[model samples]
Target: MYWEDFLHVTAAAVENTVSSKRVDQFKEALGFHGIPAGHVPPTFVRTFSFGDIKGLTWPDAGMIHAEQEYDYYRPLVPEETLFCSQRIDKVVRKTGRSGEMAFIYLTQTGKDSAEQTVFISRRVLVWKAAGQRSEGVPE
Candidate 1:
């Protein structure tokens, strides 16, 4: 996708409160044996999920999680109501031996009740044959 188009592709803001009990359950489900540390796991952001943007939908099957990175400015504590804002950061198209693919880079920022950024997550989603456009085709 063009840079201009990518700039406009983004998900609406999503918000949720961080529940301590949910964190405990998540740790147990993953076989993490330990007492509560009060600091949420980097992946805890997954507990608050959101769907695709109106016109940007991932394939129901065959989509791949290409990469992920998380930067924590401060620890996320339990019982704190947090807000998650998501957006499409970048888009790149490449062709490999397998086939054509597009890498959709997405970012989610977790903020405290005060609207301070606590953490930022960058993830790339790879979709096969999703970026190709035939001649005379219009997006």
Candidate 2:
């Protein structure tokens, strides 16, 4: 997995976007996890990402509670709700127990109606061995 230092992906805000299809999928997942329906908030989708990194570039660990929040802009809803995802933007080296590991992340943003700023999102994951951090290796 360490060799997977770089990656690029493309995705979109289709008609079934976070507000629709994803909401349904996440609700289903919650049900499978023994959680009641509606227990999972729409924001929980933020938890469903590649964010396993910690203490280094792990965004949540680096800044203000690793939080993401936004309000619905009914007026800004696009004529075509389908959005797109782009490539993995960055990856960085980190210390690990077994040796070194890479932290990989990607970005996805969407714009509508010439809004000054659309949606900017990032997903990240760690490439360290199970005990890599315990072994104290630097990548």
Candidate 3:
């Protein structure tokens, strides 16, 4: 029942404020102790990320984070508020060593109050076919 209806699952704008505390925490998590908190870490927006795309079927088990890529127009700064949104970009089906599986690509974009793009994050999630085993794993 994987219809193209999922293509319409774009979300409404989600907003977040980049606070000083958030910057510090994100930096600390990455083990950057003395970096200026003025510029946030490249992946800091993940702290306020959302993945709720309508009609998307998330696997309860055996789902893997296949890949992630980020494009930064500029570094996010503390005290800057950003409006963000997420959508499902595409879905692909393929048969590999693990059997038939699906790859779902999702992307999130963040913009400043002035409507300038700050960054974009693209992530891929893999849903493996039932009963499939990864290579080198015992059946």
Alpha carbon deviation, residue 56, candidate 2 (Å):
24
User: Is 1 or 3 the stronger prediction by lDDT?
Assistant: 3
Candidate 2's C-alpha runs over 4 A off are 1-22, 31-80, 112-118, 129-139
Off by over 4 Å in 3: 129-139
Output the better candidate (1/3) by TM-score: 1
Q: Judge candidate 1 against the unseen true structure and give its global Cα lDDT, from 0 to 1.
A: 0.71
Clash number by candidate, in order: 0, 14, 0
* lDDT (tens digit, per residue) of candidate 1 on 67-94: 8999999887888887777777777878
- Each model's TM-score, in the order given? 0.81, 0.41, 0.79
* lDDT minimum window of 10 residues, candidate 3: 130-139
**TM-score winner between candidates 2 and 3:** 3
**Clashing pairs for predicted structure model 1, backbone only:** none
lDDT for 25 (candidate 2):
70
lDDT by residue for model 2 over 21-118, one digit each (tens)? 45557667766465444343434435333322222232222112222344433322212342433455566666756565566565645445343334
Error of 3 at 18 (Å): 1.3
TM-score of 1: 0.81
